[model samples]
Target: MRTVHPTVRLAVVELRETSGPAGDSVGASTSTRGVKSTQPSRPTQRPTATQSPMDQFMPKSMSVPKQGQIDSALAKMIAIDFQTFSIVEDRGFRNYSNSLNSMYTIPSRKTLSKSLIPQLYESTQASVRERVQKATAVCLTTDCWTSRVTTSYMSVTCHFIEDFSMSSCLLDCFEFSDIHTSENLAEELLRVAREWQVDGKVVCCVSDNAANITKAMNIFKWTHYPCLAHKINLIVRDALKGMKPTVDKVKAAVEYFHRSTVGAEKLKFTQRQMGKPELRHKQDCTTRWISTFYMWKWFLESKDAIISTLAIVNAPVDALTQEEWGVEERGVQSPGTF
Candidate 1:
């Protein structure tokens, strides 16, 4: 055997080391050549310090808010819009914060209602006054209604043409005390108008044709327009008064199923068996005559399913009587005939 030259032996050893375990000649040549190597160098990692008990469970990156930032954000949340305490206390809301979790603090409902709401109301009231001052003419609408607790409330709305488009805003809603007579209503309406400085700008006032409301408008001496919708509603209501017996029977049937869970479930089952889409009966409102039309229409549409459901629930009394059924059939056939 001939002895290898020292230079040749050195080149061979260099090539073997560059070839890597896969022994690719191209990689070996690219690395061994005088050209700079294109391959990346292995990263040198330093040993990390041992984590503490808390760090082990904590997120890799955590955001810690400064005390001032947190307080400012909390105040904005309360003042920006009306939100309930239960919303902030919701399980999903609490779990959404990764940084503070149990440490995150939110104000209670009492704190918001007594402090934040009043502060916000003052600021909003000033803003509304500013907008109202810029309007050339404003139309006023007022309505009074009693709540579930029998507390009376009067709502006032302002409408004006802004940028050639009609825009409206609710000026205020306040509890009305004492008897709701025309004199009392007129006093309140004029007070609200004067407070907003819109009394002089008021060109028209619209309201339902309640005797008290019309009388109030006369006392205020404002141009009054009876609400056209209310007139139409009155006509419809008067016409339907004769059909009350039939309407009442249908309403009772619907109320029976709606108020009882077992009856509702039986209705759903009956609807499925009849291959009908599940529909809940609509209830008529004392003020809204259109609701009565919807109630009757829905009853007629789902008459078969409703009768079947009554049978399934063993509620014979709740089912419509023969005369009542005939009335519904005729009403459904000629909805306009009524």
Candidate 2:
């Protein structure tokens, strides 16, 4: 009927013997003395601790082993700060320091003799393909050069499209082989375009107005836009030829002034004078943003007096021409423009 522990059964015996026959204690053995009773079979159970924190949770037979070298706790610290991963031990996490100087110190190179390569073939292939497809449209730009290590490099530039209107503009760089001719650049461009998932969405290819690039684009269906800003710069360079001497003198004087501390102070003084409109007294030839775009941008109002004060500063006025001409355009003297 009911189960009892050994110590509990012994306590029950003591209580039963002291009790009167009129049910003072609750025990079947003393109350039913007329019937012969048989002892119940004991269950085979491992001994359990009477008092322990883990006593209720752990099985009696389960062993408690020593903690190993790589338990869970130490791994958490490394995960929190990835810089703890040593490149020597894990080659994938290499150290790269930014060095800047005329003569820089060489970084220590680790010889990767062995490494546990991850199974990323499927992942890598998917990533490579997705980069192309998600990009929608792409523009290709390429530049060729030879590196210091004598390696021929041709860098391909790709600009992607995406935005709020699903219109996004993003350009990235990838280097290729320079040995590949314009023909080769053509093939690689096509391949990379496909990789960018730009099979049909490539609206344009933008680059310098080079004949080879144009020729390559001629084969493609997409339009090619030349860098108009680069072309304009080229045009300006050619336009400067007629006034080369004036330009040269102007350049030399600017360099000289930039190098001279006295000249810089004079320029600063002029900038301060020109900064305010009231100091000039007239608007006709007073300096503004356009008059001093680069050098005296945001010049102070007091700079007008400084420029006049430094009137005899070494500005070679006669460099533009050898003729005995007046050193003035209408009435204003020309600064050393060459």
Candidate 3:
């Protein structure tokens, strides 16, 4: 037998021929043959792990802070950041929170006002009680004030030594609707001290020199001291009566600058030209004697700018005479003025 080549024996051959019937009616045919192809089977594939459809959009529940921690932080935002309860209801703030986390929801304003705030207040009260109970001796400072709406309120604060470090805490601030008398004020103080468990441990009480407070302290029978700052204020007020004319001029100047926009701008411009800080005149508050000192001090510091501004603008108030300016300078320079 003739030996056929191995390559030729394995190779598959295909041939094709086309025959046309006639030019008007043509027909064609074709055929193909090939050996079957054998490709190595691919290794079997293991199944893949998959997340659920909801998992793609949902944040990890475990990653969110606990409800208690969120409430506490919200409480701090109200107390420390001075945010109002209605802040929780703001659309912009809610959108911002949603952008940060979809899993956690902000507490409603009603919930914050009714639940979280009160809860935080109770927790803080408990902490204050614990600290106050451990003190050997505590000094109390209390005061009463009336709001612009004529609402009366009282506040108490405690000071003590803890671990050789000075510590202080505000015990309470509550509305005192009753008449402010010695008996009523004493009762309020006693109530706060007893509630905090510091009644017997209080060494002294310090308060302003108002008549009602003074008499209340007397009735409380703890060693009572009038606030030294109040006494100094009294001294300063009495000492300034002799210099009314000079004080009046300075006060008028401050009032003029505060009321007139043109004068103020001119003053600032003059200060800049003089290479001085643009310090504005301070107005004195009748209740605060220190404000008077600040006013006098600022007046002297900006005397040159004030003179220039007054000359430029038709000042409504009388300008200070050179002699009066000298007196103001001397008074401010003297250690006793402040």
Candidate 4:
């Protein structure tokens, strides 16, 4: 009965059959140096727990214990964690109607600057701090417009890093600017970065093709990405100008049919034909472009109404209609542009 460590036995056995001069000397030394050796051995490697079969399954379907038993078990355990929120009131000569900010048209910036950001930052956890630290590399964006005060206001958008699974950047909301200048915007952005301890980390700046933002990016030596989506949308509208008459005609018909009693009646009949009472107004009619797309879907749902209105409305069945309307067509042309 040999009382050998598994690793030691494996090592000795591997060295034994090498059949080289080096192997012979190593085997001889290893064999002689049994339990009390003055030599270094390789570090032991532990079996990974994550490789276990149990880790592969989550007990998502496990049944809960009886409510009474659960209640009793919870009662047996004790816990203590408490948090408090505070409200600051004003003792002033202004209107004390509701809160400190309600009375004045221009609230005290000092109050928020002194109290809010630090409090907000302090309330967050270590993981949030790490995210904030890494997210110091910011991308800035700006758009200028006249406000109700008749003052030109430039809205600043900053992209910050997020504690995310797949997403690297999260778009932070605007910080208002009274003076829209490259120098001013850069100063403000740097202030925000310094506040978050990310001033030196700004790698990119993003904005529409505005001179002010472009100038700021140039001054700061930051890489710039002009809002490609906005540029594409501008190009799309320019292209749409060529088809405006067709678009206007379709829009006029669609709006008139949906907005009026006669049109609503036609839509009701169309939904009835499709057996979809739920799509009265297309529940997700949130975007104008999507609305344009859905009008055809709604019309397809009420193909009878379409025939009743326009006999020439049998637009060739697209691939979308094949799956949606169950109308498979030969030599189908898909509505790929939209």
Candidate 2 lDDT by residue in tens digits, 260-334: 677656665665666733332111111121232232221223334433534657543333233312222311232
Error of 2 at 75 (Å): 19
| lDDT for each residue of candidate 1 in 1-338, tens digit (9 for 90 to 100) | 12654222121111122334564533333455678677754333334444335544554432355543554465567556645645556777656643464455655566656765676678778988888889999999999999999999999999998788988878889999769899999999998899999999999999999999898888868999999989988988898889887777877877787788888888888789989988877887878877877788888888788887777668744557788778877876786865
Better of 1 and 2 by lDDT: 1
lDDT of 4 by residue, 1-338 (tens): 13553222221221222333554323333546475554644433334333324533432332334433432322222111221111122444224523433322322335433543334435443544466576635555655556568765544445665654322422233546457778887776666556556557767766777688788878868788887766765664565566455445445555555656665676566657766563543322322344544555554555455445432333332223223333212101233454
Q: Sort the predicted structures by lDDT, highest score first.
A: 3, 1, 4, 2
Compared with the true structure, all predictions reach lDDT values of 0.76, 0.45, 0.82, 0.48
**After TM-score superposition, what is the CA distance of residue 132 in candidate 4 from its true location, in Å?**
2.5
Q: In lDDT terms, how accurate is model 1?
A: 0.76
Better of 1 and 3 by TM-score: 3
Query: Candidate 3's residue-wise lDDT over 168-276, tens digit each?
Result: 9999999999999888999999999998889999899999888888888778579989898888888888888988888998999999999998889889999999999
Predicted candidate 1, C-alpha RMSD = 11.9
